[model samples]
Target chain A: MKRNVRSSLGLVVVGFALLTSGMAQAAETYKMDTEGSHAFIQFKIQHLGFSWLLGRFNTFDGEFVLDQKNIENSKVKVTIDVASVDSNHGERDKHLRGKDFFEVEKYPEATFVSTRVEKTGEKTAKITGDFTLKGVTKPVTLDAEYIGGGKDPWGGYRQGFEATTQLKLKDFGIDYNLGPASEVVDIYISVEGIRQ
Target chain B: MFINTETQYGVVSIVLHWLSFLLVAALFGVGLYMVDLTYYDPLYHELPQWHKLFGVVLAVLSLARILWRILSRSPTILAAAGWQVAAARSVHWALYLLLLLLPLTGYLISTAEGSDLSAFGWTLLPGLFELSPALADWAGSLHLWTAWGLIGLATVHALAAFKHHFVDRDSTLIRMVYIKGQ
Candidate 1:
């Protein structure tokens, strides 16, 4: 009877350890797939006394670290290469990368690092973070929506999420061709992440 | 006779000059208006298409313009201040080169990214070569820089025109202005 009781106690300890490990493993790290990810940012400005001018940033990449047990502990990191900005014009693109605007030479990569993730509800979150562009960094908040996660055909664990945020160009030190007050620029981020 | 624009500058110059003005004006208006619209919004997405369409048109016009300028006879610089004449010639040539290069680079970049370079709602800008992500990225940057170059040049051109017309009371501005009779 004592032998059976000791064996049962051993099983309980093992079971407890397994459960703890499972809980600990819930802090999942996701690697971003650059080829599969898509990001776009749009901006509007007053044009030569006629109408509003619109432009977009065409290239960006991002990753997510999700903690199911503690959703608020989750984190996100994103990088946007300003040199890839496109508005469908050649002359204009070059101008944007120059000193008057992005000055991509001095500051090449625009990045966003999430400081906090506040879960508003199921599948919805308010992610506040620091966004740096053109050498300027500022606190920004993004509204992130869980687009659902699933298994890929390649047998890799994957999750898809979409986040969006808007900020003024001047916040990032991007001030050029803007008349009077700077225009408000809207940035959109769509991320697809896989386990690293 | 000191020729200002060569054979390559004749018809091509006229076409690029007018089309560039028109497209830039349109783009300026479209860009400004797009601020209020969303990405999925018809106007927002459509504006870039239109911009690309006009870019392709500008590219074609630029090529033809260059060919014509190379083959045809150009008007001579009869009389003008030496600096003014040099500025006009250089700026015009720069504008032409930038106009051609910018659009071609943009098209190649778009093609490299596997993006459909459809102009407006009708014609599709055919991809001439395989897509290269690296080249596309470089081209994107090039496109942006070129735009700034064009804007600066345009500003200089505009200021020069004003200088010629108002400050100097010269015919530089009137040279390109389409007046029925002068």
Candidate 2:
């Protein structure tokens, strides 16, 4: 029994060491193609005397880190300039940046940092993370699916990922319309990254 | 001396005040509502257009109101309890700024962020500026935050009006209201 235990322990240690060495040696950098990426933040509120109003945040920047061989070793970082909140109107956007809501002067940036990733398939992943906006942070999960990945004719690895997530603007310290603007804000993202 | 205005405001003041109120309220409601509808409904494609149209109307009304306020003399309130008068002024100013800022920022953010210059099918407005991803992002954030600010101001305004109407039994509400009499 002791011999058997020793052999199992030895195998586990060897496996761990091999995995660590592989990760250390195989670090690949991915470059995000901003032109090919889409970032939109959505919001909704009660309409005048009726239903809910809907819209999206029109501008954002996306960041991605990926290794083709080890898909598990991927990371995504997205930064949304809070000052960019647009719902296709000028006056509304200005109000959003002022004191009662985003207070953009104090908190200029809204950011998302991924925590854990669960691969659902060869091309789909469930990423969980914390999204902070207007000084409020909340756990958000995105359904990320790999659209397609391939090597370009120039020999650079290109990967495409699409992710979608939703949250309440109020969660981010943007508790503007308590019951007027529906508390929920849905976000959608589609990205195409290239390995540098 | 904490008395209300002796007479009703002029026709222009009444129109501008009510129009501005309705428009600002609509802007806030519509702006916040649009955030989520685009996600689930494909038919919601027209929403951006509506936002643009209403935004322009609000902007124009707000500009006109500002001009009118500047050009004409508005009825002055009789000396009020210090806190009530200060609160009223602050809320009114905040609402005015929000009315102007929200629409302008939304327009700039929409136009500058991309080439979708014709907010709706309307070509009345200039679709001149091109959108920069960075600038668009910044403008978008600013717009959203400003919206929240508007919401806050609105809440205060509504609450104050309610206080005058129900709690304080004051004429502040009556002055703002367009009914036959208090």
Which candidate leads in TM-score?
Answer: 1
What CAPRI-style quality would you assign to candidate 1? incorrect
Query: lDDT scores for all predictions?
Result: 0.70, 0.69
Tens digits of per-residue lDDT for model 2, B1-182: 11223455555676677787777677677767766553246535566677778888888888888777667765554335787677677777777888788877777776673444465466636656755444655667788898888878778877877876788776556666663454
Query: What fraction of the true interface contacts does model 1 reproduce?
Result: 0.00
Question: Across residues B118-145, which tens digit of lDDT does each residue of candidate 1 receive?
Answer: 7555656765664433455577667768
lDDT of each residue in A29-138, candidate 1, tens digit only = 88777776433455555554467666766677777788877899899998888877766554456556767678887888899899999999989999999989888889
True contacts kept of 2: 0.09
Give the proportion of true interface contacts each model preserves, from 0 to 1. 0.00, 0.09
Highest DockQ scorer: 2
Error of 1 at A39 (Å): 6.1
Top lDDT prediction, candidate number:
1
Which segments of model 1 are wrong by more than 4 Å?
A1-24, A38-58, A179-182, B1-182
